[model samples]
Target: MKTSTRLEQAIKKLYVAFHNNTLHPECCKQCAVGNILNNTDSWKHLSDYHGALELNYIGKVNESFGRKFNGYSPSELLKIEATFLKACGYQLPLHYKNSKPKHPTNKDVLFNGLTKVVTFLCELDGVSNVMDYTKLFEFINEKPRFQLDDVITF
Candidate 1:
């Protein structure tokens, strides 16, 4: 599939996850994205547009929770993130910096999936401004729950 096509599919998958509550909306907040990016170099190339979209989605989640940001441990957040990635038919890149690694088909799948999702989010919604990472993390910490049966389709 083309890069753009992959991105579209990824975004759709994320949307489905959000709708189904499989991926916590707060996970995409500005703070959360920043945290993930800071912790992992994988997202360094993410454009401002994509960041904004994520922030917006995170803000929406915060609104729903009546909070600004929810906090969670790095390991806990990783688990949630991994679940979303898996739902989107992708895996977590082994290393943050080497998002687009050469080896391993699984890594390629994840890199492609994340790239598509980020691009779609940047273009489709203005997320950067709406996101608050701190609030997002707090929300996650408050309620760390996932419904395994809740399937997210693209």
Candidate 2:
């Protein structure tokens, strides 16, 4: 089984989180990416010029793959975060509480987000659909130093 890259697993996790609607803090009433979409006050707390929020989904993705801001360069991490958000249909540089992108239709939101995830996955790494959470867990849990290269293509 070829191991998935850090980028691949992160994209997958973000997709799953978005799918499950558990990607954000409970108090925010929005997923992590949702914060960026709304450009609410929460977005600023998640990431500034200093560092990515260790408690947010983006940070969790970074931590899951043993990545460390790729050396504390928060801007780079934010770029990755912004890319993911953009893939989900949100524009960048969330500057205000009312900053918003063209809101996706209810049905299209998931589609857009997933599409972005797939594109990012493909471009950042060579991973594809890579679905199946149970298998991912098995792979990650079975090995002490499991490489996240085993992926399922849709």
In terms of TM-score, the best-performing candidate is 2
* Candidate 1: RMSD to truth: 16.9
Question: lDDT of candidate 1?
Answer: 0.36
Which residue pairs show collisions in model 2? 2-149, 2-150, 3-148, 3-149, 3-150, 4-148, 4-149, 4-150, 130-152
Among these predicted structures, which one has the highest lDDT?
2
For candidate 1, write residues 22-95 as lDDT tens digits.
Answer: 43212343222333333232332222232222324444454456541123223333433444344344334423
Error of 1 at 102 (Å): 15
TM-score of each: 0.23, 0.43
Stretches > 4 Å off in candidate 2:
1-5, 24-76, 97-107, 126-154
- Could you give the C-alpha RMSD of every candidate to the true structure, in order shown? 16.9, 11.2
TM-score of 2: 0.43
